[model samples]
Target: MSDRHFSHEVWLSKLRDHLTEERYAARTSRQCIAVARHFLRCLDKQKVDVSTAQPASVEAYLQQTRRMYRRRHGHPTDYKGWQCLHTNGIHMLLRLVQGLWPPAPKAVTPVEILQSEMRGEYAQWMAGQRGLAPGTVSHRCCEAGRLLDWLGERATREELATLTHLDVDGYLKYRAAAVGRRSLKDVTTKIRSFLRWLYMTERTSRDLSSTVIAPMLYAFESIPSALRSGDVEKILAATRQDCTQKGIRDYAILMLISKYGIRSGEIATLRLDDVDWRQEVIRIRHSKTGAISYLPLLPEVGEAVLKYLQDSRPKTSFREIFIRACAPYRPFRCGSSLYRLVRHRLEAANVITTGKRGPHAFRHARAVSMLRATVSVKDIGDLLGHRAADSTLVYLKLATEDLRAVALEIPTGVKA
Candidate 1:
């Protein structure tokens, strides 16, 4: 291939023909041809062989072209300058010579390193010993892997043995700046847990878990970001407009979360067998609490699920109730997809969501409604599959209507 050579005229002709075949506009084809000729001329002036030209050589030519324009105009080149055109044209020209251009490098992630170097040993430990859910294990391992990478820098895992509280502090501070308060809390908890595990297994020499102190939270440091009942209605109405198969699946998921307060992961893990049509009950397996609970299947929710199963849900060997609504039909690969589905529906309905815009908004809304209806904390906890009774306390702060009842009154002429 390197032995092959073409004259400047022949090269431009070939580029012109290729661009023409690609259905480029006549003006675009002319511009590309002009740029290609100028690029070849630049290479000739630099005494670089066109067949052996590297990407750097092409970039160098573009820089030189930019300098010439700047020198002539006595100003820096703008984005719409000739250098940008030459850059695009050179790429188009390089396609004719397959080996002239190199492929972009792939990025290596910390999670990939953890999987490859350690075979996710920590993840397995967390799952097996701590009885954590698979999702939790993945999240913990990812955060731990990132912390190790940040501490190690160019060094390897051998640095884990020498990890100090200072290193933990630096990493947590960096994470806090990048994430919000709630997310930072999760980061602090995961990292501290990771360090404790490392010490227990003799992976690290010191236990730095006690040193990692995140912000303390009262009962309701953050408000429950529940969607208003009107917004929920709008979202449901929007789903009715999308008459596609995907629309049906989304509506079913929305109903399950909004009506039953089921978590996204629970919706993903739902199976056909879990829905007892005769008994009119839907069984939910809560990964967070490791509990199985049954809730009454509402008529609307049941109908939506049935319609989705009959229309949108693909026929696959997977037993999961919900499958991808698109081609290569399979069960949802991640629980986050369910959250994104809710977000898309809300956006379509023109509902302006402010904070924590995910499927959990519906969960919070359900709890708030239950509280407004004078439901007991224990009943709300059971409804939402809360493992601890204390988990229900957060909803108490979200009962604005009840709080309004206990407000102190002021006399009409009490102003001093």
Candidate 2:
């Protein structure tokens, strides 16, 4: 067959060969082939000659194909789904066209050019221009990519320019319904940040950042009284005298939570230098507020931690206070470790576990106990390293009696 009249099977075979030769994963190759086949079938249904297809023809074919697919599938054909079906088909098509007609000087469309340019520019700006934290940059890039993916098989920069507040709202609502509230909130925040970047960089004419703000859920007054002091005491007592490395580490973690109201993340990030034996204070660095605060070391908490550090903690070069107890032991890198430790202890103690009873529960418990003891809200906020007094005020919910005392009193036996 002439190159211009290459059959559907021939083009598909070439596409499959390209995917395999590029070392695409097995699943990816299958998906790419599927998308290519679909696109070719779409061309056939439109009676378009694939061999004579130009860039404009390709664009028109994609639009008609999307409408057809939506009519058949009852939903618009999303670019992500199409891309997944034939991984990087657009990029491959561009390359293939250039290769087949080297001297032709293939026409470059604005949308195609913009997508390519924006991707590289956004990545570079996120890394060097914004100097965002590595994790933050990664998250924002992923979110932006998702938005592009939603634009479907022929997304363009102009379409992005035309996006309205309603579009953003719909996207957020779709995400919330698809995933969960927390994930929706996270992705929305990332999108908002990206929009801000776009506005600052003059990528868009109008600022769309104001259209998307994560709604405030409720304020946390105190840790939910998920488990009572009795239950916590029981869990700790069960660990008494076990003396295993895991047990020692867990006990120490629990003690700190109960006594200091220290966040699990704070405990995981604790360093050797954080403890000041002379001053009896533990400095918590890089807390949620990105500020450091010191808490006086209680004798019980200090002793528990010292015991674990010396006796149970695996010897490692890691500067963090805690480390994994198992083989190939590594420093405790995040709050999840502390949560697992608490969970295991709770299971061992036979306490019925409930909503997120990680090390933070101990923090909540401490805050509630302190409030019950009439500790000032300001002092509680300081101790907890909370930047705002309102954050600490959540403990008032736990202190029902305190609130009741200040409420208006009823007159004795007055008839209505």
Top candidate by lDDT: 1
Per candidate, the number of residue pairs that clash is 0, 6
RMSD for each of the candidates: 9.5, 13.2
Q: Candidate 1, residues 99-119: lDDT per residue as tens digits? A: 445644333876446434542
The local distance difference test score of each candidate is 0.80, 0.73
- Lowest summed-lDDT stretch of 10 residues in model 2? 98-107
Estimated TM-score for each candidate: 0.66, 0.64
lDDT of 2 at 202: 69
Model 2 regions lying over 4 Å from their true place = 1-120, 123-132, 178-186, 199-206, 213-226, 404-416
Q: After superposition, how far is residue 288 of candidate 1 from its true place, in Å?
A: 1.4
Clashing pairs in 2: 31-85, 32-86, 79-152, 221-394, 221-395, 222-394
Reference-based TM-score, model 1: 0.66
Best by TM-score: 1
